[model samples]
Target: MSAKYGSGGWATVAIAQSVGATGALIAELGWGVTGPQRVPRLSAVDKSILYRQSVSSRATVVAFAVLPVSVITWLLCDFSRISAIVISLGSLCLAFSPAWFFIGDGKPGQLLAYESLPRLVFVGIAALLIHYDFPIGWYGGALIVGSVTALSLSAICSHLGFFHWKQNWRTIRSQKEVVLGRAISGSFTSFAPALVGLVNPLAVPVFAAVDRLMRMALAILAGIPNRLQSWLGAATGRDRHLRSLMSIRYNCYLGLVSGLIFGLLAPTFVTVLFAGQVSFGYELSALSGFLLFLICTSRGFGLAMVAAGRAKHITISVLCAAGVGVPLLCVLGLYFGAVGALAGQILAETVGIVIQSRILSMKWKSNRQWSTYAASVLQS
Candidate 1:
């Protein structure tokens, strides 16, 4: 079945594929960032005390994943590419923008000067673009991808206890490492997309468009693992077993909590944002339920990646496989339509996650089963 927003079925596939490619490129940033100079400069708004103090991940989660919604809006709104470009930039700026807090030796409430000054400026530009309703699908992602680059470095910085993370020859190496790592993640991701498509072609695009925001929102926890590690390392950082257990605790609890929130809110949020009207179908509802389930699953998976080495090794693979699976799903859609396509995707993701989980068990220093994983986080 074809939706008329863009060019119908095939065009949807092309756009979806393009998004996949972009996601792959961005995944490299988080999977790879290694040093401080490599760290992206933050904008003024991002640096501001007000924004940092006021903004909560819970409140603004919908705003972050606006790419898919923006695309849908553009299709329906008939907004100019210029508008789209502006919107995308704004989102990208937001995605990249974060104010650094001392949280330590300095004022516990203070902003890191280095991070604040630049973050303020950049996000200022971004905020302007956002108010204008810029289209964010095309490059917004690329911008966020760059943020992950910093995230990568942040990982090493925290592990080494280098609060003053900066770029160096070593971090430069991170660029390549990030891409390579993301490729690994993309390949695994392909499994989910591929199988889903085999079951239901419609599922691929449906999720691609809908899941974009949700996925990004869930990924916010990329910072949490480090936070956990840092805390564990602290004097009273809590018990080693307890600290280690934070891995599962945050993954299962934070993720599932977010997933539950997303499952409930994402539907209405995307509906009004993308469709320009709020509506939901049973299929859409079930799909939405599944979508949140997947995101919740990612919580444990992301921590697993951090624990193992890099998420890209597993995540990139799953996404890339899903990308490949989409077209195959279309063929299946010719027969089974949406549900069948979704079935294909579900099976693929299930199988792939299982395989990846197995790999994680063998490869991981500590392994948490998925069921237990979700439960742990839920308790947290």
Candidate 2:
């Protein structure tokens, strides 16, 4: 009993350190070095804190390793020059190795099948059929595989304590409405790669990395305003002060930063990293265009909708827009080439953002007015 207690105590400490580190790194990447101060240290007995710590640490290690390498690969396009593939594989091995060892799994197939089977099969099919290697087809296949991988594995890994966190089997966070919003958010990651995936399956790798990292960044950036608005909306039920204000700020900020980066420096970055063999400006352009749209919707619009209990409307709107936007980008790309193709992407997204924002802003205003009145009556 004494020996077992000692081991678990040490495990908890290790996990706490990991989460603190993860929070620090993400804060650095998203908001820069000057963002928020380090979160409070974990108490050994605090499971949530411990779980957060491990998640943070594992995430930081993974992001720091993957982000730079993906950027380099995007710029250089040469597998030989970038060294990203080897590093990523190696890094995964290292990060997961400790946790993997801690998990005693005598039933290997059972664990793999239940936890990771669907996603593994998806990737296997894509690779074996050269679906990923094929142009156009690669995008769709990769999107299906990649999005599902992040969603499902993140789900599984959490359950198995693979990231050193407690299992949270789909709370309100994973509700149908929230899940719908997340899918819309994920499309920004998926759409650009799918758009150009037909040309080279390998490109999906860099694209997926960039998309995931950027979404992570946006989530961090918009987190504060979104949270504030969400709380207010729940307590008060219609406060645009939190939702609408934050939405525009987040959206415009994403578009501005990403656009500037892609337009000004993407080609140069690609050149240095790819060793000048492959180019990624067009790829970056497509990605930035779609992501910019997402930032606009996510930062402000989506938060407002959920707070007002209008997630169903938001989800439907996103689906309809995607239905129109994706096909349009494909058709445009077919006729006009990649640049022209992305222009259509930009157009579709702008239209979607505008429609959602306007409608949601109105809802927010009306709801807040009613909420303020109710609060006043209660106080009286």
Candidate 3:
């Protein structure tokens, strides 16, 4: 897409992606965050019920949000209005994904077959369209087609039917804390590009470039915490504490190593991926890498807390981070451009890590037996 479209076009795509992602996050209703932990505990029948409730609740939210989200994208977009709106709508279609369902069910085959494969195929098709000089709107249409197709296949295979609105609403209310935390956290990341674009159009492409790479890498790294969520959720007593301790240690190492590698390789990645169209220097790339490390480490702590049923602490941390980060991101983007925004993200994630770690430590202190077991196990 970058090769086909220059900086201006890429900026518009970034804005559209931002708006669509924000809408999709709302439509997901925090299911992706909390679902994995819940799935391991549910019976087959109950699992189906949960999936139905999630779909029903998320569909209703998307029905209401589509128009407003498209309007927001249009307003933020300085390039092509039609293309932006289409892409925004395409992104919103991701709400239908049943990935969390499959993950929690320990069915990677289902996830790959029904969700990942279809999405990849459609994305490839979209690329072909772009290469052929087809309207960019076709790219968004392809996303919609891919997402809906995957949802349909998953639903049919899972034998899902009948969505009860009241039941779904109740489910949403039950998970309100998780939903709120995810919403705030998702917004800060998804909307940052648009916010920066509002201040510095020139910085949008550069910021968007690094942000895209960070997001892609983070998506792959997400498997670690997600796998831990399932493991910790299913475990009890000493086992759970042991897994949590291991998660913290390994995630810390993963963050340190991954951040260093990404910082060193980011310039080359930009040059290769964008054909040197996007100007990303070492200093900015290094800062973005630091931000990525903070994010990965913070996510590890937050997901561990969630697995331990400490959703409220995660929500509080997200709220605090947003309170500090949002204003800082905008101000920094206004003055120092993308570098300032990256710094703001790093600071926000640092705050989240501190709060989550503190909460987890408190929880450990209250559970003396588990804490001692974990410490001794680590020593051995």
The CA lDDT of each predicted structure is 0.42, 0.42, 0.83
Q: What is the lDDT of residue 288 in candidate 3?
A: 84
**Model 3 error, position 283 (Å):** 0.9
Q: Which stretch of 10 consecutive residues in model 2 shows the poorest summed lDDT?
A: 31-40
**Candidate 3: Cα lDDT at 168:** 65
Quick one: best lDDT, which candidate? 3
Off by over 4 Å in 3: 160-166, 369-380
lDDT of 2 at 181: 40
For each candidate, give its TM-score against the true structure: 0.49, 0.46, 0.94
Error of 2 at 15 (Å): 34
lDDT of 1 by residue, 137-203 (tens): 3334444444444333333433322222233334324445444544444433423333344444444
Which segments of model 2 are wrong by more than 4 Å?
1-174, 184-188, 198-240, 280-298, 368-380
Q: Tens digits of per-residue lDDT for model 2 on 141-217?
A: 44335433543454465353333334422222233453454355324223344453444333343443334344444
